[model samples]
Target: MIFKMAWKNIWRNKVRTLIILISIVLGIWAGTFILAYAFGLIEQRVNDAIGYEVSHLQIHQPDYLLDNDPQFVIKKSTDLLNTIKKDERVKAASQRTLVHAMLATASNNAGAKTMGIEPQGENTVTQIASCIVDGEYLEDSDKNKILIGKKLAEKLKLKIRSKIVLTFQDTDKNIVSAAFRVKGVFSTYNAGLEQSTIYALKKDLDRLLNLKQEAHEIAILLQGADLVTDFTQEQKSKFAALSIRTWSEIVPELALMTNSLDQYLVIFLLIILLALSFGIINVMLMAVLERVREIGMLMAIGMSKLRLFFMVVLETCLVFCLAAPLGLLLAFGVITYLQNTGLDLSSAYGESYGALGFRTIIYPQLQAVYYLRIMLMVAVTAILASIYPAYTALRLEPVEAIRKI
Candidate 1:
């Protein structure tokens, strides 16, 4: 009976009810859209980091990461690679010979970290082949073929088939220089990485460094992100001598950003709800004030104070219940459409996003749980917003309220 009365009473003033409903709907819809965008940006950053910067996991000799010395090679790397390949949780694994070398063109020289990778294995573990913007990826048949980033190529004033010399210390502590022709130019979202990394065939680097089949690093991609911890733990037990690190440990800043995203989103939603609550409070109070005489008559006719307060609260809840679902549905449809046709901010803000290693095209995403939480938050805010108006109704003197103009 109270719910039916509250519903009918809220609609008695159609203009006021519509005004409040519109506010609630817009508030929920805007909040949801903003959160979805945030989720998309975070997702993109993590994907790019995993796909290009670091694979899910990496295995390295104890001192190899500390100093890029050619002597600190993983023992029995081929056997370890085979063992890793047989694991069902692993999507791909690649053995790499790493060296810090100076890349020299005829007129310019830049320091870069050279990665010697198996052509096929590297492709499986990283998206280097797909990120090739110009020319072609490395192949087994191509000897001394090198891949450089577009940014680096521009800095060095070099292009495809340009001969560049790499100078580094070999396994025996002797400085050796090898000439490599640029076979591919790749570009990733990360500007810093683009200017300081190079790639070559693992066989060529192993021979140049006199390491035979030994490798300094083994990078692995897991079938899914959820498998990272379990896979890393299992690999740690098997390869205790080698240092195994997940992408989180490799990039702590990215891990921190991902971890704090949920909390930040909660705060963002609360701020929106807080603002909307004030508007609700004003509208509900006006409803109460306008009906003062009617409320007094009901009280005088034996309607209890508690019932009047509860009726007002119920009205507030009904307003939210009516508006929340419509808002959520609209948000869902818009998000779904944007997911397929990404929101392109590139034309307006390409350089800014690129500087932070983010692509300007974003596909907004939110889990089902987020919508549920938003609905709950709206319900709570409605109840809280009704408190002052409900109290004002309870405080009314029936004799005085009935006589007021």
Candidate 2:
């Protein structure tokens, strides 16, 4: 009876109810929007940084993972590449030979790592072609041409078609010297890649190192990023001699940075939610104040204080039970629209994410747990926020409440 009376009383002051509902809506919307966008941007940066440099997965000789020495070569890389390519999970695969040494040349010199790549195959799995700003990406047709970092090119005072000499220890522990023409200079938002790496044709490095068909690593692009773990496990059993590694395993610093950012954002959102809970408390208090006479009448008519308190608390719950789902629906609608249209933060933000190794465009995604959590938080807040109001109604003297307006 008390519950039915309280439910009817909630709609008596329609304006006040609307005001509180609006506040709840706006608060949840802002929190949802900010958290979703921030997470999306972080994900974009991590993937871009990894894809731009590391692809998704790599296969190397068992010892090469321990120490990436030029001498640690995969003897039958072609056979392994063929076997990996046969897997339906594999999107694209490329073979690479690497030499880690300082680059010395007339135009510029620095400690640099050289990566030998199959140009066409790399394009399928990497953003290398997009990174090229000056000249063009190295083609298989260009035997002696190399693509270099813009910073490296600037340090060397080199231009397109300019000649640069590379010195590194070959597979046989001999210092091999080779001359390469600069086919292009690539610029990345990634400072590390822009400063210390150079790319050359696999054939060129194969000849320079006097290698017949050996490679240092095989880079694989998976269809989906999350599949890296499952694919790695599958590959481990399929290829016995090689070690499989994901981008996160190879580059832990990026993972650490993104993970910290995610945790910070989650904490910040929780604070906002707590603030919203206080707003719910204020509204419930006001509802109890206006209903003192009604509460007193219920008690006079033989409704127990304990039952009245429970009813008032249930009233608070009904508001949240109705509003929370609506809030979630509204949040989803807003996020989905923004995701499809893409929040045009690029113009205002201006590609500042290059340092973080992410693209300017951010695509929002909804995780099931996030929405589930929001629902739980709102429900708990509504129930707990009514405690003070419920207590006030219980303490009211029936005669005094009836005498007052």
Candidate 3:
């Protein structure tokens, strides 16, 4: 009976009721869309970080990561790699002989981290072959061939087939210089990576370093990101002597960013709800004031103050009930369309996003839980917003309210 009365009462003043409903609908729709976009952006960053930069997990000599010394190579890396490959959790693994070195050409020079990689293994693990914009990925048969980033190529004023000198310390701590022709030039969203890293065949690099069949690091990609912690734990038990790290441990900032964004989304939604609350409060209060005589008559006829207060609260809830589903549907439609078409900010924000290693196109995504959460929040907001107006109705003196116009 109270719900039916509340529903009829709200429509008695159609203009005011509709104004509040519109506010609720727009607020929910905007808040949901914004949150979805933010989630998509962060998700994209995590994917790119895994796909291009960190892979899922890494194994290295205990001190190799401390200074990246060429001599701190993983022992019997081939056997270890084969063992890792046989693990069902692992999608792919690649061994790398990394050295900090100076890369130079006739016209220019720059310090770079040169990575020695097996072509086939690297293709499986990092997918570097797909990023090649010029020339070809390093091939096992291509002796002394190197893959440089397009940024580095520009800095060195070199192109494909251009010869470059790689000078680094060999295993004996002796400075060794080797000549490599730039067989490929690749480009990635990360400017720092593009300028500071290059790839070469592991055999060629091992021969130069005089560390046969050893590697400085083993990069592993898992079938899914959720498997990272479990796989890391298992690998730790297997390779107790070597240091194993997951992508999150290696890049704590990415983990922190993802967590922080979740908190920000909650805060953002609260702000939207806060704004919508005021409109509800205003409309409900006006409804109570305009119906003073009717409320007085009901109280005079023996209706309790508690019942009056509840009727007002029920009215407020009905407003939200009418609007919430429509708002959610509109938000869902927009999100689904954008997920397929994508929102392109590339032209306007490409350079900034590229520098930070983020893609310019974003596809918004929202989980089912988010919809449920938003609906609960809106319901809570309606209840809270009704309190003050309901109190005003409860305070109305029956004789005084009945005498008023």
Clashes of each: 0, 2, 0
Query: What is the C-alpha lDDT profile of model 1 across 1-405, one tens digit per residue?
Result: 888999998999999899989988998998998889889988988998898878898999988778767899998899889989998888999999999999999999999999998999999988989989989999988899999999999999989999999999999999999999999999987777788899999888888889976999999999999999998998899879899999999988989989998899889989988998998889889999999999999899999999999999998888988998988888898899999998999899887888788888999999999999999998898899889989999999899889987
Which regions in candidate 2 have their CA more than 4 angstroms from the true location?
A: 1-16, 101-107, 150-157, 188-191, 225-227, 253-268, 321-326, 344-352, 397-405
lDDT of all predictions: 0.91, 0.80, 0.91
Kindly list the per-residue Cα lDDT of model 3 for residues 168-274, writing each as its tens digit. 99988999999999999999867777889999888988998998779999999999999999899988998899999988888889888888987888889999998
Ten residues in a row with the worst lDDT in model 2? 350-359
Residue 159's lDDT within candidate 1 is 95
- My TM-score estimates for the predictions, one after another, are 0.95, 0.84, 0.94
Superposition error at 157 for model 1 (Å): 1.7
| Between candidates 1 and 2, the TM-score winner | 1
Best by TM-score: 1
Candidate 3 regions with alpha-carbon error over 4 angstroms: none
Which residue pairs does candidate 3 place in steric collision?
Answer: none
**Local accuracy of candidate 2 as per-residue lDDT tens digits, 66-180:** 7776778888888878888898888999999887756666745777888899998888878899889999998888887889899778887888998878888887889888888
Candidate 1, RMSD to the unseen true structure: 1.7
List the pairs of residues colliding in candidate 1.
none
